[model samples]
Target: MEEQFYLVWPPVLLLLLSLGRRRRTLVLGLSTVVVAASAASWLSYRTPSGGSTPDVYFSPVLGVVPLATGCVLALLLDDERCRSFASGLAGHLGTWAGAAAVVGVQFWIGDDWTDHAWTFGLLMPATGLAAAVLIGGLVSVRTPVSVALSWSPVAWFGRRVSYSAYLWHPLVIALLGTFAIGWFGNVWLFAAAVIVSIGAAYAIEVPVEKLRARVREARRLVAEDHAARSAAAS
Candidate 1:
């Protein structure tokens, strides 16, 4: 069956825009959007192209619920007095709890990601919570893990090869499958794809980053000079 992602995106966008508005209005708007999203997802699932499963039908609803709720929580609970508590809750307990929930749910559902167990159930909310925690932690950390991870072999090479490999790996996979190379097993197929992706990133992407960095630095320097000149004139 052909996949179309627009089914999931529109309602999420509406919910995001409704954040920070009046509670009554926001709640009404979000409720409407959620129902619409759920219905659309379900209809898409029931359509002849796809099989009927509650998970597939309700995937978009699952993702938007946490986002809408969090926005509401942030708006309604915007309290200076609770800052410390919110920080602590977000950092230590929230991040790990959400991650564990995802791992647990995956195990329970037998690791079926596409059929909707991963998309609609615990995975989406867990992802949102994990993102919130990671962002919070990164903001607070004196020396961020990004710095460490950036230099790690996995990250460095992964970032470098991610682009060309991402673009070309699909074609490579299609070719391999067409040629009956998949007889080796799915693991080998995946491994071969990864190796190809990394090779492409290493060979094509690292050099492009150098040019991109230089351009960015030049722009920064120009902006700094303009600021200095304005200060001098003032």
Candidate 2:
């Protein structure tokens, strides 16, 4: 739970992102190193019976591959031929397979989590890869998956407050814990948390945005007044 374990990724990701468009080679090369180092670390990691390596446990190593993978994808997607190939026959089925794999992989992890070396080692990257594919499929113009995800209400709420929902869900669950939510169930607790988080996100978002707009308007007015005075004095 020590948050410092999460700190290494952001700076590296930012460094990759900060390079100008011309720094493709440097960014790609460094990203590849990150992915490799992360995998190596994961593979070589030795956890005690009850102890945890926060870095691997938090899956920062697993995250590196995806960050690098995304960069590779952005490069590939930029090519028209790659785009055409992605929309081709195999592409369609691959996305669907990826989505199914995401669901199936969870069961796999639950099946014999502790004993499986490969599964435990590769879990983060494999799962992240499947998830990236599912997200890719959902946004793809050629797939019905896109249509399903784009349903008005789902998309609207997701766009509006998904971040808020993520931020507030755990807090809501902790708050509700004192009530002994077993009366209804954990599912009820989760649902309540989501609702609270979304509402909180929306409430904060709308007011903060309005305030920002007002501040921008006030600045514009001040600039206009200064310009007008300068013209008159001239």
Candidate 3:
């Protein structure tokens, strides 16, 4: 939960990258440095009390690593060398292996091993890159999983509720915990969170979005009217 504020780092980095989009080499070099610094910080830094590494975990550097990796991967999509690397049987095997390694690392580390730098630094970014590649590849190929995800209802629900769910679910879980609702298992908790979040999001966001759309339309119409008047006057 403390890490929520640090989530801003990804978008901030993305904005910087967007600003420097024309300078691809410079952006790549900076991204590489940031990633390396993040990993190095994990490897070198330790808490004074030798407990969990919350400082490193919640640091802005670590927060940007995954999204930064994704951005780098996106940039590489146009590269002939990268395309060749991702096209063949070897590439397919590498993608699956990377995915498996991600899962295996999580299983090996278990839920209690939060202080490990190797997990945060090396494994996390690797897994994030692997996931981006795997998912991108799947969607590009239009696999059955991607097709189901693209279904109108599913896509609409995701577009509408995903951000709201991400924000609200933690609060919902915290509230449920505070209420001493011990009967709810993980699945029940997840179900409750989704239902409640979706309803709340629809109630809140739908009206706001409609208002925004109306505002944009009004502005457009006013601008067009002014332009027409100027043209007629001229």
Candidate 4:
């Protein structure tokens, strides 16, 4: 079941590629139908072998409905005609509305969030919708609170180290537990994990990216030099 998670990429790639080849309207329609259908029938899906975990890869039905929502959002946002429209949409989402949205999501979750199966079940699509709106607001030409959020040093630093942080977070949590320190819920534990994750990002991610850029530059120079030599010889 763990291995099945990797299976998602191939289908997602195929779906995205298919959408890329289609007209904007067609892609929107297709994505809408997919997300709607997946959400509508999400409740009926059962886990394999009576396990607690729901099988994300539901064979004919894709696991990530919210992923479809993201695809639609991407399609809309990437189009030149959509640029103004997206900006307008973002400008309309004021600070008050953003606060209200957060409250609504929290209220929907309630106290016993984990125990509530539907909350967990519907979370992905809900999160996708919320993220789409927030992202749209941030990237919009005219903004209010989103502008502040974008400029905030905390957000800037998190964005820089986020990928490596993601990679290390689970391992950090596990190590803390093994060492009898603390679990994920502890603030101190999270702080330590974040520090370690940031260090990892600085040590690994930055270096790898720099090396990749240098390799690309080297390849380009080699190609140009070869062309020059050929031209000179001729």
Model 2 scores worst on lDDT over the 10 consecutive residues at 111-120
Residue-pair clashes per prediction, in order, are 1, 0, 0, 0
lDDT value, residue 28 of candidate 3: 69
Full candidate order by TM-score, most accurate first:
3, 4, 2, 1
Predict model 4's lDDT versus the native: 0.63
- Which model is ahead, 2 or 4, in terms of TM-score? 4
Clashing pairs for predicted structure model 3, backbone only: none
Error of 4 at 14 (Å): 9.4
**Alpha-carbon error at 19 in model 3, in Å?**
12
lDDT of 3: 0.69
Q: Tens digit of lDDT per residue, candidate 3, span 9-117?
A: 4676568668865547745675786578566757755643554445776665676677566666666665766667666654556556655666676667764456566
lDDT of 1 by residue, 27-83 (tens): 566556555554454444432225334545345455565555455445434544334
lDDT of 1 at 58: 44
- Cα error, residue 122 of model 1, in Å, equals 8.2
Instruction: Superpose all Cα atoms of candidate 1 onto the true structure and report the RMSD in Å to 1 decimal.
Output: 7.5
Q: Decide which is better by lDDT, 2 or 4.
A: 2
Candidate 4 regions with alpha-carbon error over 4 angstroms: 1-25, 33-41, 44-63, 94-111, 177-185
